[model samples]
Target: MAETSRQIPERIPVNLIVNGNRRTLDLAPWTTLLDALRDHLDLTGTKKGCDHGQCGACTVLVDGRRVNSCLTLAVMKDGAEVTTIEGLGRDGALHPLQQAFIDHDAFQCGYCTPGQICSAAGLLAEGHAKSTDDIRELMSGNLCRCGGYPNIVAAIQQAMAQS
Candidate 1:
């Protein structure tokens, strides 16, 4: 009988500009961006509601676009600018969306707030939503189990108007 050798998975290097900070990490090829952000880098602001990408609680900005962090592989986003909820504000000043969320009470449980804010920022940047219906359609991906859609839409509308 002949013995066969097993292959060992190799670690891949991933470079990401997160929250205005550059990070280089050597991680397993299978590591998801959400895991890298939450587990490795300790950026837990991105939630893990449903790892399958059905829920947008793990949403983040990759290269200025909203993406489900859990659905994106860390190695695939090399040289990309990644922005999580923690990156949205600076020096105790909240981002416009963040302030809007607060002003409108857009969150209740707060588990989905990060993703909601990130998605709203992306929507505003896209400049496609002009009405509450459009905002709802664009932000439908981020689910708040607390059922804060009305306030969420209001917050986004307020932020959009201000922007």
Candidate 2:
């Protein structure tokens, strides 16, 4: 081992309100929102599937909008409200989408469940999905490798109905 020493850049300050908690973090400007959430904040509910923004597994709500966290830099979301899967519920109760996923058996491996639910919540919030087909189209970004599309749609529909 040649005692390799690599220079690390200085971390910049970024502020965000995550899961209803204000967080101040010092991180490299190149750090992605997904990395900031999972690596720095220990909020691992956001997954990194493609790291290229092709997969919605890293989806999160930034200022009430659905975003691919992996493609977004931490500094880009500074002073923004970020919501991960862990923030969807309150009072020890599951969010409607979470419960719907359980009731509809929307997940198998469950790896993409968090992103799916978050995306669904954003979909509902956007209020653009008027039909199942619309939901399918809007949620096409979040891919479920287990082929649980039907159940996932049903879960979203259930959550939408409840809303």
TM-score for all models, in order of appearance: 0.94, 0.94
Task: List clashing residue pairs in candidate 1.
Answer: none
Q: Which stretches of candidate 2 lie over 4 Å from their true place?
A: 1-9
Consecutive 10-residue window with the lowest summed lDDT within model 1: 6-15
lDDT of each: 0.94, 0.95
- Across residues 7-119, which tens digit of lDDT does each residue of candidate 2 receive? 76789899999999999999998999999999999999999999988879999999999999999999998999999999999989999999999999999999999999999
